[model samples]
Target: MNIIVISSPQQELNEASIIGALFEHGLEVFHLRKPTYSIYDTEALIQAIEPKFRDRVVLHHHYALAEKYNLRGIHFTGHYVKSHSDQLTNWYDKAKQQAMTVSGSKHQLKELETLEVPYNYVFLSPVFDSISKAGYKSNFADLKSIEKYKSATQLIALGGISLDKIDQVKRMGFDGAAVLGTVWEKPAQAIAVFMELKAAWEKKDQIF
Candidate 1:
């Protein structure tokens, strides 16, 4: 299992309330995906958080903060990944040298194929349904086809991954999961939900 990453809310962009809850439940990596926030706002939040988690959490779209804060790594959205291909020339080799991990999002087979961005992992989405972004659901069968690209990219399933679908998701062979509404809507219940999903995955392992 890679990790269960919590995507920061665009509306609130409040990292303080989430850090304590996520840390208590042993969440190591976080993706601050608020595209609306200015880099300054993201930095202020990271400044407040990095001291507590050390090198565990990461901020997305806040590349300037990466060096100053010593974040885990950077996460690139599909837009960033696609548009910055030329910029990422020799990135794979460089990333290996720097000991840094990169991640990006993919919604189409074409996007997945073009994901030669030298990132450590990839997130394929709406395996079921999404709350934040409606109509983001991809065909389940097509989503499963993503496994063929696993050799090139570590695929973390996102969107609609819930307690009930954990077993099926594991069977689909995703590297990990990235959750948003399921965790953010009720921060206090984060641990319980994490436990339930973990249990489902664990139980599935037993039967196999």
Candidate 2:
């Protein structure tokens, strides 16, 4: 599974250092998910890292940043999809014209089931309770139900993902996993977590 890290500084993490670690660990897909941050803060972040990762990083909930920073694409939230689905479709169509992929979030299997449009991937969350978003729960048993939609959509599991859960996610047949707290707690430790997850995934693949 491909690993994606959400951008945030956990209690001990320095944002820049963590981001740098992600790159070092071969994490190519990053979601700049600072929803509560001001534009200036977000802009500064984009200015700092976007240049180095021009084609690899993805900004979440910020379409303007993508156009301004030469990012790969934007990861839309459920609110964005529901509120501006049509408008975003045009954006995606235009992006596709340029060979870019558009991704989104789907909290429930029904959300994934209801989509009549195209989204490159949908991040389904709470595969387990995560430190980043506490109280959220992941229904792992529902994976079998979600697999039915694989033909029409690519699912990326999010929320509380860590090295240990790699096998469970793979068995569920997810296309990828997006990590936040697991790597954000210590930027320097990010690569280690990533390496372990990769190694675990490799082992799982060998077993299956």
Best model number under TM-score: 2
Per-prediction TM-score: 0.84, 0.87
Tens digits of per-residue lDDT, candidate 1, 1-208, equal 4456565466444557666566666776677777887988777777666476747665567575765666677777767766876755554454445555777777755666665665677777767788566677654654544556676568888888777777677778887887787766666666677666655656646653
lDDT (Cα atoms) of all candidates against the true structure:
0.67, 0.74
lDDT digits (tens) for residues 73-182 of candidate 2: 87777777778867877778767776666888877776776764687788987777776766777755446545676865688988888888888888788988888888
Residue pairs clashing in model 1 are: none
Q: What's the lDDT for candidate 2?
A: 0.74
lDDT (C-alpha) at residue 157 in model 1:
82
Task: Give every collision pair in model 2.
Answer: 126-138
